[model samples]
Target chain A: AQSVTQLDSQVPVFEEAPVELRCNYSSSVSVYLFWYVQYPNQGLQLLLKYLSGSTLVKGINGFEAEFNKSQTSFHLRKPSVHISDTAEYFCAVSVLHNQGGKLIFGQGTELSVKP
Target chain B: GAGVSQSPRYKVAKRGQDVALRCDPISGHVSLFWYQQALGQGPEFLTYFQNEAQLDKSGLPSDRFFAERPEGSVSTLKIQRTQQEDSAVYLCASSLAQGRTEAFFGQGTRLTVV
Candidate 1:
């Protein structure tokens, strides 16, 4: 079983300021990590994912996440944020060996970018 | 590309009423998944289907909740007796079934049980 935790329920930042959304996971086996964003009244869109080979994963909209094995953390970050980047962010994990593995998601962090 | 799409973007039902939500995955995607998202929460896995076969359903909350993807393209989630607790946005997603591919999602159907 795998579980994800996004420490911040809500993060408020001014436009052009850097922001980081914290995510941590617990899993007994090797896993894959992912970050997703959801706009108002929309479904989740894949922001980034961390599989094998690379601990640093980049996604669309200039966002990126670092997967830390020792810390069990995969935090999403961007050098700067825009008002358009305001949305609900989620972190998810999937089993690497379990073919039937399903994504387990976090409670979510609402990123509010104010101008 | 036209992303995943769902029908009846919003639905309202009285308690004990049956409701059906529909999802259409991207064309030719082999894997489909259903999730439930309560307001202010992330989506929770509900079920998974690979092709026309149901591979997993561990996340369905109750026997009243059922999902089917008969032809492996469009899927339907049927709630036998909708309850207030069932009020949430039902999301559908599809992936390539290849290595490390990301899942694309539909806008989701919001079910309101009054």
Candidate 2:
């Protein structure tokens, strides 16, 4: 079985400040990592994914994440954030060849950007 | 539709009643999935279907929960004798051909059992 753990349940930051959301996974097999953002009453939107190749993957809205194989971590980061970026973020993991690509998600971290 | 679509954005059913949630995946998508998201928690996998065949259903909480995708394009999750524990957002997602492809999500149907 695979699982994801997010270190923070909530993260508060000021506008234009940098932010990082930590995620760790436990999987015996190679896995694909992803970051998703969900606004209140809305579906989840893909932020970024780390499938293969580069360890550093960049995603939409100037967000990025690094897949550290050694630590089994894929943490999301943004150099600067805006008020519009406030939302609930989830870290997910999927086994490389799992049928239907079922995603195991973390508890989620709520990001609140203040002015 | 441009993306995955779920109907009845909100549903309220009395305890012991039955409810069915619908999901419309992207056209031509070969894989579909269902997940449950409780308050303040992440979505948990419930079931998976490839084409019209249900490949996995191990995540279903109990036998009372059932899902089906007859033609593969649209799917439905039926909860029999609904309970308060079944009150959560049911999300549907689909991918082009499965594997490592990105799965687009629907807005989800929020089911509340009173």
Candidate 3:
């Protein structure tokens, strides 16, 4: 079983300011990490995923995340944020495919970018 | 040609009413999933389907919750005796079943139990 923890429930940032959303996870076996973003009245969109090889993963929309094995963390970061970036974000984890792997998700963080 | 699609994007059901949410996954996608998201919370896994077989349903909260993917292309989630607690966004996702592949999500059905 795998679980994800999102440290913050809400984050407020001024437009063009850098922002970071913290996520931590617990799992006994090798796992996959992901970040998804949801705008108002929309479904989740994949931001990025950490599969293997690289610890620093770049995603769409200029967002990126780093997988720190020592910390068991995958923190999402963006150097500059836009008002359009205001949305809810979730961190998810799943055990590498052995059987039918199901994704476990975090509580989600609502990002508010103000102009 | 498309992504995951869900129908009846909004549903209003009275207490004790039965409701069914539908999902049409991307063609050729072999894995489908259902999740429930309360306001301000992340999606909680409800069930998973690998083709026509329901591979896992341990996350379903109650007996009233039921899901099926008989043909493997489309799936439905049925809620019986709808309660206020069931008032939430029911999301559907699809994947290729490959290792670490991203899951595509639908707009979700907003179920409001009045």
Most accurate candidate by DockQ? 2
Q: Return the TM-score for each candidate structure.
A: 0.97, 0.99, 0.97
- Deviation of model 2 at A67, angstroms: 0.5
Better of 2 and 3 by DockQ: 2
Each candidate's DockQ score against the native complex? 0.65, 0.82, 0.70
Q: Model 1: what is its DockQ?
A: 0.65
RMSD of 1: 1.2
What TM-score, to 2 decimals, does candidate 3 have?
0.97
Order of candidates by DockQ, top first? 2, 3, 1
Runs in model 2 lying further than 4 Å from the true structure: none
lDDT of prediction 1: 0.91
RMSD of each: 1.2, 0.7, 1.1
Question: lDDT tens digits, residues B1-114, model 3?
Answer: 499999899999999999999999999999898999999888998999999999889989999999999998999999999999999999999999844677999999999999
Q: Write the residue-wise lDDT of candidate 1 on A1-115 in tens digits.
A: 7899999999999999999999999998898899999999988988999988889989999999999999999999999999999999999998735455578899999999999
Task: Please give, for residues A26-102, the per-residue lDDT of candidate 3 as tens digits.
Answer: 99898989999999889999999998998999999999999999999999999999999999999999875654657
**Candidate 2: residue pairs that collide:** none
Q: lDDT score of model 3? A: 0.92
The CAPRI quality class of candidate 3 comes to medium
